[model samples]
Target chain A: MTHRSVFVVSGGTGITAEAIGNSMLSQFGDVAFTQHSLTYIRTEDDCRQAVARIQAAAEQDGTRPVVFSTLVNPTHRELLNQSGALVLDLFGTFLQPLEAELGVRSSQKVGYSHAVRDPSAYRVRIDAVHFALDNDDGGRTHHYDKADIILIGVSRSGKTPTSLYLALQFGLYAANYPLTEEDFDDLRLPEALQPYRDKLFALVIDPERLTVIRQERMAGSRYASLQQCEQETRTFAAIIGRYNVPSINVTERSIEEISTRILAQTGLQRRIR
Target chain B: MTHRSVFVVSGGTGITAEAIGNSMLSQFGDVAFTQHSLTYIRTEDDCRQAVARIQAAAEQDGTRPVVFSTLVNPTHRELLNQSGALVLDLFGTFLQPLEAELGVRSSQKVGYSHAVRDPSAYRVRIDAVHFALDNDDGGRTHHYDKADIILIGVSRSGKTPTSLYLALQFGLYAANYPLTEEDFDDLRLPEALQPYRDKLFALVIDPERLTVIRQERMAGSRYASLQQCEQETRTFAAIIGRYNVPSINVTERSIEEISTRILAQTGLQRRIR
Candidate 1:
């Protein structure tokens, strides 16, 4: 396997640069890489320092570093270009076209992208996180009317993470309910969730993976047993069929994939957008 | 503001495309855009379908749509290119150079990139979220030894969301403890937190913002009063001076910014990379 020096440099948190860089790198399955994420590289001086670090890393690794940058300032972009690394300028590539199409000049400000400019809008996202926490896992089922979506599944079937992800990423008030053994006995939607059936979304997982997942949480209990997992899987399917709830199997899906699928399947609006 | 139709198309969840698109478009602050996210566009057929949708929307909106995509398949890339919608091929622009440097052909497999290939590793992030929940708001201070970093802040001072973001984004075990009047009585770190001093990171917020945030949560209460917020801010500053703990003022910063700055200032490593 080949090794490479990788750097994700950005003016803001560097998250956008890293996301696209990782998505692209994920396609190349062979190479090994060690990533250095240098964020808050706002000024020309920061850019120069970033380039120096990238150059030193390239020299040490005996390979040119791949620098993924979202630096908006032209001066910073030019300074980093001098490093001669494989610079993937995430912003510079598309900003000019967007600017031309919009017939406006880009602001080119570093950091403070959305937070300070619209504090109230950002606060809604934070409030959604609190709402998810307050209503997680049948904890506050009475508040179902307020939720944008309600995820239902057996315990350890990914209801919690999905709820949290929906809240954090999309600013959606997502409440989840873990279908207990009693509900599986008759394969019926929980009485508490019946009132908000329109907002229901079911998640099912493979039995083998559920066993492994539950085993990690509780090693020897019946809950971790393969038999229990299979039963739960069957229960989820039966309930989905009976209730006709919009559903997806989340066995191998990332939170991003699952959340996106949910939004697409349910035609739910993301509050962030 | 000139209105335009924006499309984010991707082979995977489309998160990478949307993130980069949003980050770049944030620079062009004035133009109004209606974004349509098209995810799971994998095959040549899917690409053609995506283009049809984009072209239709562009025509309806009376302007060319801007497409941000991370499509990897060369055939799919060519098909989308023909859409003539000002496509920003996020992966195509950088993958060839990466392939040349790495000396390998790209896998180009869409979705299931990380989840199925490395389920155990992905499970670590979910486990981190559980850890954050289990230890949230001084619930399990005894588990501090397991934490990569412990955030200390006043209530509604961005501790909970920051902790959750740290756990979800970085896979770091982040437990947050809210400092109360009891702790601020003598401007001291809580006795429970003293043992974890090396892992301590303080978060301070502007009194005006805190008052407003608190007012939203508990309107007309003493806790939401500007006087109470001012006192808490002074208390936080005093405690930070006394304990000499590393900290940041998260008054106007996003969770991403605050979390990144926390990792940088504390030199705490993110477990994801």
Candidate 2:
């Protein structure tokens, strides 16, 4: 099998290139790819240097690298094209037609996706993040009314990260509550959560996976034991089923998928685009 | 002034459309647009429904709507094109050139960016996010050894959100510590932070902005007072200066800029591309 290298190059934060690279990775698995790389080349000189580096690596490995770039500068793009790699210009392939269709010239600026100039949107995201931290693991339940969505799960069931993702990505106010042994014993939603039932979304994971995650944090404890994890998972599922709470199995899902499913189920609007 | 509506339609997660919309907003202030819009239409029927909705809205105001789309399906793209609106096709204009350059067909899949099938990258991001939450506001200083970067700041100075953003977007292990009155009184770094000095990055903000942020949390407390805010800001600045701690003023900056600058200054590698 021949080894292949994939490089995601960009003029800015490289988010666009990364997104494209991720999409490609999902489509084509890691079978032939030895390296998945990122190069942030902001200027013409940096672009040339990056291309030179790619060329040097290709020469050594005898495998022409695949480059996915979103460089907006024409001069830099020309230099990248001359590098003898399979260059995919994310912007060059699209911007001209978009400009003609919109009846306006493209700004052709780098790092435009996540610019710092928009203070209001930034502030909203920051506030939502702070909310997530304050209300983490049911630290404060009084603020559930203020939350756009409340995530409920057993400990280490991936509530905290999903809460933070929703806040940072969509500027959505998210709060997560951990279901404890007491709640599991009673097999009911917490009294505090009753008022905010409409906003509650449960996240559950496979007992085996939960055991492995817990073991990493605290080995040889009841918390990390498969038996305890199994019990907790069963109780949590019962509660979710009883309440008819919208839930996702986080056993094999990413925070992105969990958050997206919650958003789709709840129809919660993002505070920022 | 005329009221105008802008819609970002995509067959995928709509991230590209959203990025372009945000860039346009920053370039042209929200003079013409009412709200930043996003419509994720994955199926042909969904596309027709979205177009019908747009057509209905356009008929009401006689102002043709502006649609920025990344529909990869030719049938859906054609439907979008016939919506009687000014449509900018992000993928339709770019995929052909990309296909020809690479001599391969595009996948043309919907919701490809955050697909759950690719779990390794997603797992890394989720783990990084968990690390961030575990170490938030110096919650668990013991894990500082695992952190790629540690952010220190006075309270409400935008540390939490930036930490979470760095984790979710790049899968970087980021931890943040809040500088309290006790640390400022002695005019020294927290004893717990001394060992991790190399990972330290400080965040500071304008006294006025810090005061305003605090005021929202605690209306009448001394923490929210301008005098207290000014004193804390000065002490934090002095500490950062004394230690030569790499720092950024987040007063007028977005979390995106703050996180990007932090990553650039620290030279930390993103776990994910």
Candidate 3:
């Protein structure tokens, strides 16, 4: 299977770019992909820098590559004009025409409106969207019959939210499984999951973020302790390494970017839209 | 505050339209409006019939005008061609422009994919989106100070999912308050919540659907029994009635339609987006 590079998403105000990018990522299956958002790009120089990165990804890969982007403005369009990759402009192509046809003025509320003050809600929805992408039965052999993807992660690493997002937004049957201490100590996946090891997507996150998340749920609780969170995170990472399983660190990116990268990396052809 | 006679969002996918409409619903304080979705209209005749109902709504008391159908297809648009109310064509406005800008063969995936199955995801997201509209701490009296809009209900009544959707999708700080048995007995809004009663959007559901959703999480458990579900639902309805709170029953309807209607009836305008 050939791996494509460069997925771009541009569109509505709130989470449109991230949402579309995440959808495209689920289609890719397990190779790593880099996502650079132009939301912070302040100058033409920054735009060119983004273009260079896309050009590099294209040169490194030899396939019908795709670069998905969602831009409300035309700046990113000019940047990608020379990138030699398939670009997806979500805003101008989809949102604008629909706005015109519907005769409604632009509301500018879709992607850019996320409230950072309440990162708890942001993280939850982000996790929901990503969790909904696993196409395999939630790490259980019997349930594989129902899964389009299986997501494995330690507690509060964002499986539920991501799973809901994928299943809800895309009609994908996504299931999630929590990795327990037993699974880590055993250092082996269940026999049922062994056959579909290649289909698993391990969501890795930094201990600090994990701790913060757990603390919100059970403040001052042992489960929310930083030490426990770090230990579990480390063990989970080692487990993935031991099995040669592919994983993604969700410490730095938003849910939309993370899901898109996973789909792109996985190279799983989405059989249904 | 000049309340629009009706706010009809008749475009985009059901999920997106609901999400936007839900957010917009929080803006009109105390003014009543009714929301309807055109998803059920399988024929042009159905579309015309739905429009007639909407016209009747617009002609009702101008303060509590009706918010009409979100026509998702061209046929619905034809039906609304002469409807004098405010028509919001979300799908048509968002989809075409996105597809054209992307230069893709189709924009179906990103613009308006249908919720063919397991629509719970979309409903949750849309509810969250709607709640986010009024999530604020300023000038919202004590008890009400913590929330802009508090979604109260028993388990599996779609509270958490909706709250997060409101926060993430529309930047609303929507917080959910679960209705415990104690609160049910009192059958009144928390005294703290009384000051903001005007801002409340009660989400009531049909006994059957409420049972179905709760059963999914606790299958075969006593909590999942239809009798138990029905009893709880009745109690919930009684509580709303005792308080004389306004609400809508979400049964045989998708979340998009229900949330849209909630917005219209509330006469709430979404925060600028």
**Best candidate according to TM-score:** 1
Off by over 4 Å in 1: A111-117, B111-117
lDDT of each: 0.85, 0.77, 0.53
Per-residue error (Å), model 3, residue B209: 7.3
Clashing pairs in 1: none
Task: Order candidates by lDDT, high to low.
Answer: 1, 2, 3
Give per-residue CA lDDT, model 1, range B1-273, as digits (tens). Answer: 788788999887887788777777777667787889888986778888999999998889888899998888888989999997989888888888878877888887663434323676579789999999999999888899999999998899988888888988888999999999999887778899989998889899999999999999899999999999999889888998888988899997888889899988888877774
| Between candidates 2 and 3, the DockQ winner | 2
The numbered model that scores best in lDDT is: 1
CAPRI class assigned to model 3: incorrect
Cα lDDT tens digits for candidate 3, B4-88: 3544433322333444444444323343434444333446676677577667766773433333333545656766766655554
Q: What TM-score do all the candidates reach, one by one?
A: 0.96, 0.80, 0.40
Model 2 residue runs over 4 Å out of place are A1-12, A24-116, A184-187, A204-238, A249-251, B1-6, B24-31, B34-89, B103-117, B185-187, B218-238
Q: Comparing candidate 2 with candidate 3, which one achieves the higher TM-score?
A: 2
State chain A's TM-score for model 1: 0.94
